[model samples]
Target: MLHYPAATPSDPVDASDDAPEAGLLPRYLARIGYKGPVAPTLDVLAALQAAHIAAIPFEAIDALTGAAIDIGADAVDAKLIGGRRGGYCFEQNGLFLRVLQAIGFEAEGLLGRVRWMLPDDAPPTPRTHMVVRVMLAGRPWLADVGFGAAVPPQPLAMDSEEAQPTRHESYRIVRHGDVWQVAALIEAEWRTLYRLDSVPPPAIDYELGNWYTSAHPDSHFRHQLIAARTTAEARYGLRDNRLTTRLVDGRSDRRYLTADEIERVLSEIFLLPVRPHWRPAIERAATAEIVG
Candidate 1:
């Protein structure tokens, strides 16, 4: 069974309030060097999605560094503006939601569970993801800019099987019985990305799920470090201390790095803010795994 909470509208802002029309969004986008137009239309959504994918990356470094993942808007703003780095789902989606609102799109936050890329019989682990619901031209669509490798910028129709084109890939949603599934086209084949029911989810509904994803024993991020970005032909990721780049041409390259080298690569290549606490945490987790 699936559960969702009601939408809680963010505090209202007066039109006369001169609190920077661009708000923290344009600056955050600028920090990541995203130079794009900001009109709220289908074409603009596509452009923004492309700019977002090319600039701000999906990452989990902060959670590994001992920083709390607060999904609140102000906290997210502080982290992006104050820390000058990227964040995982909570942070990225929180910030992206505000940007969508500022850009004149009607948007709301939604939550989802992640069913790993295995058999359909495997139970889904609920609250593993966060997404946004955007209303455009009287249609409700899904907008996610923080799904790490699954980020899709253009708002996708909530209940359609039409192929929506984005800069990164073409996406579609299908319904099987009561369950809805998201898929991405790769090599001319449809690949299941994840699935969710038509349940409305609220912000607080995700707190527990977020906590578990960051702290649970079996959580992938708890024991490994992963950061990835999509390029024209391949997806590059740092997995558990190894850097693996998968090319669209079906070539894969893996490299092992020392602790110091990992730190350097994370900061320099992945654009992560390497903190002192990260090394010990990664070491402890790796050591525990080795002994187990």
Candidate 2:
């Protein structure tokens, strides 16, 4: 069994100042393009999950720019409201947890190891991802909108074989021994992506993991630029300067873009506002790969 950090309010919300007036939820919904009234139940969780996957993308530009990825509520709010952009697992899941709390859901942060689709013989890398566990209607569900391609919109019931629908792919959670694994159906076969035990993780646990993901030399985010978004039938990924889109039918298309085109696509498709300094950084990184 994996050890998880205890839950403690990392950044306490002050009822006097930081509390969102009742209207705050509505504003957030509008910002995320949610077209329905705020439901009082776990329906809000589903709505927020969909809206987040649709609106706030899964991006990793901060690692390229050497910005410290912070995982606190105030920091997440600043990035969402002030920066006017999306972030990777730490920022996206952190903000999602805060929104769940604001709307009266019992949620807690959880950590997981990423098993990349590289190879089976590769060793598992631990403590590099963050997700959330929510207690709704006397049951626990997994909610993760930060993952780029395979994000599901609704909370998936733990230990369930039921196929859950999202804005993207069909997902299911299954238990193998003491470990719980979330799998996606590709070509009608289940693929075990990552596993997490029923361990409650605190905000500080994610903060440390975020640091390594953003700053560690061997981390994938350090050497490459990756931003991905998911639609119901397809998933698009920009890895380094190569753009690839894979369909549910197992068809994939890939193309390499110039540095200028990469920046343009980031602004146009991904909705990221790039600074002038980032342009040269991307060019240098992409050119280095070509020259080497």
Candidate 3:
């Protein structure tokens, strides 16, 4: 079993806040299409999170293509902001954490054990997923834009057990024993998303998790093609070749994509750069055993 570090609220684990230069803030804002006021207020944080999930998509193309995943600040900025590409949790949340710090929001990174689709009898998993906790107006809010398909568009008040409405789904945070579990309401059933620890692990743990998730041969990201993006009206998800679109009003549609359509949807819908060398991998993932 993995040992998680414990810390009090006052001594929460802090990730590196060395934001790229002053110009990075503007570039990131432009990349996410956020034109709202930049401040440390809750409203601004909510707007920024909403805009980010809509703009910068979630993807694991590099892992599929057998490339090293870099979670460094400069690499994240270049790929997510400068390059026309999407990334998985570490890159997405890592970048968002830095951006929030740049905007002077009291924010830090948190780790979670993903239990989204695992069975009840499944064994314990590692702390792989990354999230953000923001302190504003004397309270903490959970803001995560890197959870792919079911990511919450708006920040959720950490103290509330009420069903919080977001752009797409309803999310609630519940305490179980010493841990907190984030769940989403799906088709009238509540599904656990992940289990989070209040005290964040050291930054080195994030680096290690990224390496396992992106580079390890047994990692699911290496075998699957996963991508997701959400707009104001609906949330789009692609697992392998199957594409699913869930509207805000509770209607959903699913369809499998051809190899040619895969390229189109990845480029046009998810806004990911389809490089020339990635054709073989794309074709393989498109033709794999279909599972929606």
**Top candidate by lDDT:** 3
The lDDT for every candidate, in the order shown, is 0.66, 0.71, 0.84
* Model 2 lDDT tens row, 1-292: 1121232323322344456533345545555766544433565566567666767768888788787777676677667645767788888887777677776678887887776463546777768777888987788888888887666656788857777655445787877786677877766766666777667776567767888899999887887787877654667777777877887676899878889888887887677777787876678656545321
Error of 2 at 170 (Å): 2.5
Task: Work out the TM-score per prediction.
Answer: 0.79, 0.83, 0.91
TM-score for candidate 2:
0.83
Full candidate order by TM-score, most accurate first: 3, 2, 1
Least well predicted 10-residue stretch by lDDT in candidate 3? 1-10
What are the clashing pairs of model 1?
none
Location of the lowest summed lDDT over 10 successive residues in candidate 2: 1-10
Answer with 1 or 3, whichever has the higher TM-score.
3
Q: Tens digit of lDDT per residue, candidate 1, span 148-245?
A: 66566456787678887654468888877856678887668777766765665765677777788777768777656777666545566666566767
